[model samples]
Target: MHRRDFLTFSGLGVAGLMLPHARLVAAEELLAPADVARQKLLADTVLAAAHKAGASYCDVRIGRYLNQAIVTREDRVENVVNSESAGVGIRVIVNGAWGFAAAHRTTPEGLATAVGNAVAIARANSKIQSRPVQLAPQKGVGEVSWRTPLKRNAMAVPVKDKVELLLSVNAAAINAGADFINSQLFLVNEQKYFASSDGSWIDQDVHRIWLPFTATAIDKASGKFRTRAGLSAPMGMGYEFLDADPSGRYELPGGVVGYGRSYDPVADAIAAAKQAREKIKAPSVKPGKYDLVLDPSNLFLTIHENVGHPLELDRVLGYEANYAGTSFATLDKRESGFRWGSDIVNFFADKTQPGSLGAVGYDDEGVKTKQWDLVRDGILVNYMATRDEVHLLGEDASHGCSYADSWSSVQFQRMANVSLAPGRAPLTPHEMVKDVENGIYILGRGSYSIDQQRYNAQFGGQLYYQIKDGKIAGMVEDAAYQIRTPEFWNACSAICDERDFRLGGSFFDGKGQPSQVSAVSHGAATTRFNGINIINTARSLG
Candidate 1:
């Protein structure tokens, strides 16, 4: 078979094998408006039943998802997928203990059974509890629904067009002499309808997209291998996101049109090839304390590990100790004027930022989302909290951090769009690098490790360049940095302007008891730090 034909057939083959049963499962009749109203009625019925059964509190979550993915490797289309899911979860507080149950079926009978099972579980668990669960006080909320703005629905796009785009990207890489190229694109559109006994009703529509690419090259002479990986940040966007130049203005996109220029993926491929070649030949780095300049891609991960996870009140209170370790930064310290960074540093956790991966109109707990501080002027200020943990932190109400990655999972406090506040004055990344007389400029995230307490941590990066006499010398290898959390932030000397900031994130950040994967974004500007411990990975191996 021709390469292109084989690629097309491969995708079809996989679809043929897996889709028939999946389609059957997803073919439930769409809920009519009256049916939706009845579902709400059923939810109220279940909540009332639980309360009458001696339950303290109860809530229900109904979720539906439409997911599609396409992948291509060099000349071969490796995978094509389309799937749908719908489910409901019932949660209850019985005698101060929590219990939960979920069912894929959305019938009134199914929901009633799930709620009954939850109450039973909670009653059983209450026997071993020490104190009655006390949720922070909150006023009753009324019905509301929100949908993110989209120029075109992702599902409306033809599958063939998406496949063609993937193939084109793969071909571009192959033309640059990449021995192997792999690319994957995923789109998910989720709809959730939530109802609570407090008169709160919420409907939310959220869309997400992910694009990841990997390329590998081999040297026949030395038998050495090198690879490059690039993963795009997931955005709350739609099919318009896939358009190269939706406005027809820019040679690339957004702007820069009318300027004598051309849009070509080959240019990107050439740059990647050159970078891969240089990285393989770069020399190992020397270990010592040195000033450092961090690009946004590298610094964002630092923020996620240090500021994001540590500031979660649940993690600080040891609620997450069984799985992910708890934070040394506690609630008391957060408000006690603890210094978290240099005087210029400030950070906020926001769920309303435009295009942010974590942006949500309402949390899984049915609470309206809002923005708040995690750090201000170097002082540790706030911890991400939900309604249940708000009282522990002496807060009035939740900051709306609750989240559940799947319909079956229980809602847990999750990270928000944690972001560093940009410098008041404009400072470009180039200027920051120029200010560093002798330092290393780190770009892209790499291997990372942090202690159980989240105090000491080490990070490596995809690319590192040595700086000397206020100029980037060349690419360097075997470079890594280690520092205590407080010490690391204290050393922050400057942060670049807002224009220098970029969003970076991971699709599979793991947390919770049953283990759930959540996608979160961290926005950061290029930053500089002083006197950090650097290591030579090549020498350390010996």
Candidate 2:
């Protein structure tokens, strides 16, 4: 389990933060790469042991996962940590059944024992197996390496520098008249090595970063409070993500600062404080059907739940039912050419897009990654599939969606960066707004609810504006939109072009029985959905 699983930060000390899978490490170790020759040598030993024990196929993953979190509130630094986990997981097919074992030990004897257990488990499970496992054919590249193109490694940056940045960000919020604020920076590095009996030797170094914070404003006289959150997106980049690149900033209407490839947290905090104060007196929505204009920050989560999760082949095939429920987009629906959206709607599943969390050269299972269509011209075309699941789709090659959160976790089909395609014609959010008659413009993610099947849902946003007669009238509060999955996508009438495109994502998207978190990104331009149901949340509460 990750640190987020059971972390209660109220009174925990540094020792308490450590898990068996992760331990506090020296700062220098964070930048150090694991030895490749030694990892292959260790893997070869495990493979030979599995083969000797009646295995037909074998693979090993040796991973070094590193993470750093710095949390601050108001004027004080709450916690700072640098942790690392290093281990190996071996999987084998014995008697046509899959088995797996993991160990922290890199010694040959320890790996041999893990191999013995894996083969034995597979042999026992084969007796009751429904059928032999089928994996699509894969030709491995003998030796290859890939790394996240980086200018500076965040982990290598001084702790003092990061802390000072956070402190300054908090001060900015306070100076703008915020009652309270919380800010945090999360950085992760995954150094992974994969070896298999199929002659594949692969190595990958991945980096991801996120800086999130909330600013609150209170009206002491009215006993009311409102908040605004930072617009920064978690990204697959180096420390440069925090830089205040003016070219990367989007000054949306109402003076709301929208971040793209880079962010300025200090500036965002200043804006957030001012926005939160304005939210206090913002008028309540006069709930009714209205066109909705959704910024990427707010639309990304919607795409993640309604589109990304439901189209996983594992979910549609019923092999996965733990993340709330299985998918409604079943095989028959996909094969029958289900209309998922308007002719203008296009969505793709990509794992190779630069600066995306899921942008890896190869998946954990050693398949070369690439982009493919999930929905093309509004028709359901495919589901995200791995080497083990591609046979269900009658495909010979994997979509390369396979991933394991850590060395000890079993590899499985995970969502990639599923994103909406931009409009072919030149368009911008400003131009798109001019065409609207009556609509609500929503920015950033807020409270959301979706059904177990990921069908019916309601979504809220951090900032909302009423658009009347082709213009933003002013701010509004307690606004949300309701949707039926198909109706929602089909309602997509207009989408801004690439110039307005931006990425937003979750750093910890949890799925499975023993839930594992995977970081994923979703990109979209400003988009418009017609005649959606709007709800007055305050009415429901009262």
Candidate 3:
């Protein structure tokens, strides 16, 4: 098989996992106004049945999920697919224990049966319960609807247009000296309706899109190969994200362009081809302790792994240890004033930030989403908590972090849009890098590994630039950094201002026993960490 063909098949396979199931329906059948009304009715029926079946509290989620993927290589379209999945999931508390059930059929009888099954499961589980679940108080916000404010709904866009875009992107990479290129555009639409016993009936129309591609430049003579990935991020926006914005674009210090709300895939592909070609000849780094300057693309994943995952209240309390692993940021660690970062470093977990993957008006459990401080003045101040987890931290409200990933999955504590606050005083990436005598500047996440406790870890990036005499010397390769979580964050360094802030996100962050995927974003300015251990990965391999 051709390399591009193999990549296209692999891309489709991953997209299948992302959407889970692809039950195809006519566009009108799946998206008509009547369908939404029917979903709301199904949710109402489930809630009513749960209450009648001796349940104290109940909520139902009726969802219609749509996904489209277009894959291309050079000037050829490999695959174009459209799939949909619709179902209703019901949850209830009976005898103080939680139970949940789901059904693909959206009929009134099917929903009622699902709700009854949930109540029965709750009662059975209560027989062996350690204690009744204590849920934090939440006042219901009456009937409401929230839609992602989008200039263009990706679902409404033509597949031909999407295919043309990917083909152009591939051509750009190949024209810029790429030996091989594979590009794909994935679009998702989640039409959800929620109704609960707490007098809340919420409906939401959510949209998300991701454009990812790999550009490889190979040297068959020396047998060396290097690849650069798309700098674009998965966003909770629409097709409009692909629109170019000259005014909003930032000129990065290292001659790279940084995108804000919009992206230019053709330009990024052109740059990726050049970068990958150069990477084949980039010098390998010499291992030593040197200050590290991190671009937002690189720092977002570090923040996700070290800060976002560790601070999930369920992870810290060991509720997720079986699958997702426990956290080192335990209750005692927070109480003892553990410094999670430098005094200048601050972090916030929010679901209210526009354009972030985690942004939603309300979480799955009907709690209104809001922002809160996670790290304050270098201290571990709070953890991401759902309604059930908040009371353990002596909090009276949920952090609105509960999410289910799909209608069939049970809701649980999930990460929010955790972000590092930019420097209060004026600063820029150039200014932050100028003071470093001997250092490395890293961009884009490459590979990473962390212990079960999310404490000790090592990270590598897509591009590394050697800094000598307070200037970017040249590109470097085979560089990775090792650190203990607290020690790593406490290195006390400068951060660029909000003008330099940007978001990077994950489309398939997995958790739980059945392992559902959640999309989340982490935002940060270009930041510095001082005197970190830089290892030569190639040297170690030898």
Model 1 TM-score, 2 decimals: 0.88
For lDDT, candidate 1 versus 2, the one ahead is 2
10 residues in a row with least lDDT, candidate 1: 252-261
TM-score winner: 2
lDDT of 3 at 101: 93
Each model's C-alpha lDDT?
0.73, 0.89, 0.85
Taking every candidate in turn, the Cα RMSD to the unseen true structure, in Å, is: 5.8, 2.0, 2.6
lDDT leader = 2
- Model 2 Cα lDDT, one tens digit per residue, 1-542: 12353143212533333434898877777888789999888888887888888899999999999888788889999888888998999999988899998989878778888898888889888999999989888897999999999988898899999999999999999999799998888888999999888889999999999888889999999989999988889999999888888999987765677989888999999989999999999999999999999999999999999999999988888877754688899999987999999999999999998899998999988999999999999999999998878988989999998999999888999999999999999988888888889999999998888887889999998999999988999999999999999999999999999988899998888788777778999999999999999999999789
TM-score per model over all chains: 0.88, 0.97, 0.96
| Model 1 steric clash pairs | none
Off by over 4 Å in 2: 1-20
Better candidate number, 1 or 3, judged by lDDT: 3
Which of the predicted structures, 1 or 2, would earn the higher TM-score when compared with the native?
A: 2
The alpha-carbon root-mean-square deviation between model 1 and the true structure, to one decimal in Å, is 5.8
Alpha carbon lDDT at 367, candidate 3 = 94
Tens digit of lDDT per residue, candidate 1, span 426-500?
887777777777898887677788887789899888677888877878878888999899889999999878765
